[model samples]
Target: MTTASPRWFKSSYSGTTSNCVEVAINLVASHGTVPVRDSKVSDGPSFSVSASAFSSFVAGVKGGRLGV
Candidate 1:
């Protein structure tokens, strides 16, 4: 089963065609889990990650670990 309805928030820096995916804002502290999905596929498959893992992912993004 899927986690939840697909909702998204594009990065402010992303432009048209937005290669970056927008994350679901609904899965905040209450769930203690961060949910992420593709903006183009609203009802598509999504994955959930631990808050700490999510934090690390964000750090990697900022640190250029993912190479943008």
Candidate 2:
């Protein structure tokens, strides 16, 4: 997939620093996995995930379910 098509989004929580990460969402023909990448490296590597896995991740994050 072309890097141009992925829409990168920044977290609402950010600090006053030059260093920050961005998430790119690429929902294409791959129906299950959600592609995520760093904004600094648009052409860099990315991680893939199933839709259910992604949801669980978000839920854990919001609910502090990770036990971190």
Candidate 3:
């Protein structure tokens, strides 16, 4: 088994806002989930969503269906 960990990153589109979220997709292939966390809170709690669900959410955002 592979020993993997989240590799978090924030979008460049986030600009300089302190209110941002980071996501780690590195584990998705093995874990089947995407981990997300607040950029301001590195040690804070993070949550995971199914890869399919995360993909849908991204699509919605890209299509402007999520109001950005």
Candidate 4:
């Protein structure tokens, strides 16, 4: 089967810096997971996390629980 590619984007909170990761929100609905990768490494390895887990991680970051 042909797989769909994840559309990755950096977080809005990320300023002009290389220390940032890109996340593909599109995959959450179709794949039930979120693909993540380093913004500086476009051709590098990527990893996926469950949608719920990714959501929790984002919530923690927004709530300062992740200490981001």
Candidate closest to the true structure, highest lDDT: 3
Off by over 4 Å in 4: none
How well does candidate 2 match the true structure in TM-score terms?
A: 0.64
- Cα lDDT tens digits, model 4, 7-52, are 9999777889879999999877788999999999989999999999
The sequence of per-residue lDDT tens digits that candidate 3 reaches over residues 8-53 is 9999999999699999999899999999999999999999999999
List TM-scores for all candidates, in order.
0.71, 0.64, 0.91, 0.87
Using lDDT as the yardstick, the better of models 1 and 4 is: 4
Candidate 4 structure lDDT: 0.89
Q: Per TM-score, what order, best first?
A: 3, 4, 1, 2
lDDT of 2 by residue, 1-68 (tens): 33345566667776554355655455634455566766567677877777678778989999998989
Worst 10 residues of 1 by lDDT: 1-10
Model 3: colliding residue pairs: none
All models: lDDT? 0.74, 0.65, 0.94, 0.89
Report clash pairs, candidate 2. none
Superposed model 3: Cα runs more than 4 Å off? none
Instruction: Find the 10 residues in a row with the least total lDDT in model 4.
Output: 1-10
